[model samples]
Target: DVKVTQSSRYLVKRTGEKVFLECVQDMDHENMFWYRQDPGLGLRLIYFSYDVKMKEKGDIPEGYSVSREKKERFSLILESASTNQTSMYLCASLTVRTGRGTEAFFGQGTRLTVV
Candidate 1:
């Protein structure tokens, strides 16, 4: 099975601290995404990369950025972690040529608590 691995299952960050969350995929999928899941708000996209060295901002890109230097690795960066930024961070990937309901493979998720 295709697997996405996240660096951390839980992260505690204080306000105004830089943070990096790593993700790696075993399958050579072309699409990767980072999303923040908040209570009642659901998952909101933070960024996505369709290819190596390429990145795109998603719905909630403010205070966050992403990097994809290699085909199998993607990273999410928080310039300054804030309390409001506290949420469950999810990393996911899918094939470039997708079929209907081809669900994305997800990491275990990083539960970040910005104090």
Candidate 2:
């Protein structure tokens, strides 16, 4: 079974503070993604990495960044937290196959609150 673990299930931070969200996967997937979920916006991709030290910006990348220094770990960084940035963050990992579809494994999710 593939296991994706998030460092925190809930987090609280003040405005202008830096925050870190960490995720780990055991399946050795080739792709990893970071998404933020909001009430009506749904899941919006913040960043994704296909290989170590390689990252691509997604739908909403402002004020956020990601690091994939190791194959099993991906970290999301909020450079300066804000109230509007408060949302549920999710990390997912998947292996892409040429001819077949692949399922992504997700972390439990981290609900962040900024005040």
Candidate 3:
């Protein structure tokens, strides 16, 4: 079974603190993505990496960044966390080359709260 694992299920941090969210996937997927879900705003992509050492910013990349050092591991970093940045973060992996209709497998997600 394809699985994506997030290091933490919940996190609470003070403003201005740095936070790190980690994700790993068992499937040797070619693409990994990080998204944040907010009320009404829906799921917005924060970043995605198509290959190792390569990353692309998504819709809402501000205050967020990602790292894909290894094929199966992707990390999302919140540089100086803020209250508005608090939300549910999700990590997903997919093999886009597996055909046009390939689906992404998602991790359970991490709910972060900033105060």
Q: How many backbone clashes does candidate 3 have?
A: 0
Steric clash pairs (candidate 1): none
Q: How close is candidate 3 to the true structure, as a TM-score?
A: 0.95
lDDT value for model 1: 0.94
Order the candidate numbers by lDDT, best to worst.
2, 3, 1
- Candidate 2 per-residue lDDT over residues 1-115, each given as its tens digit: 8899999999999999999999999988989999999989988999999989999999999999999999999999999999999899999998766888788889999999999
Least accurate stretch of 10 residues (summed lDDT) in model 2?
95-104
Each model's backbone clash number? 0, 0, 0
Candidate 1 positional error at 18, Å: 0.5
- Name the candidate, 1 or 2, with the larger TM-score value: 2
lDDT of 3 at 66: 84
Any residue pairs clashing in model 2, and if so which? Answer: none
Q: lDDT value for candidate 2?
A: 0.95
The C-alpha RMSD of each candidate to the native structure, in angstroms, is 1.5, 1.3, 1.4
What is the Cα-based lDDT of residue 109 in candidate 3? 98
Kindly give the stretch of ten consecutive residues in candidate 3 with the minimal lDDT sum.
94-103
Q: Lowest summed lDDT over 10 consecutive residues: which window, candidate 1?
A: 94-103
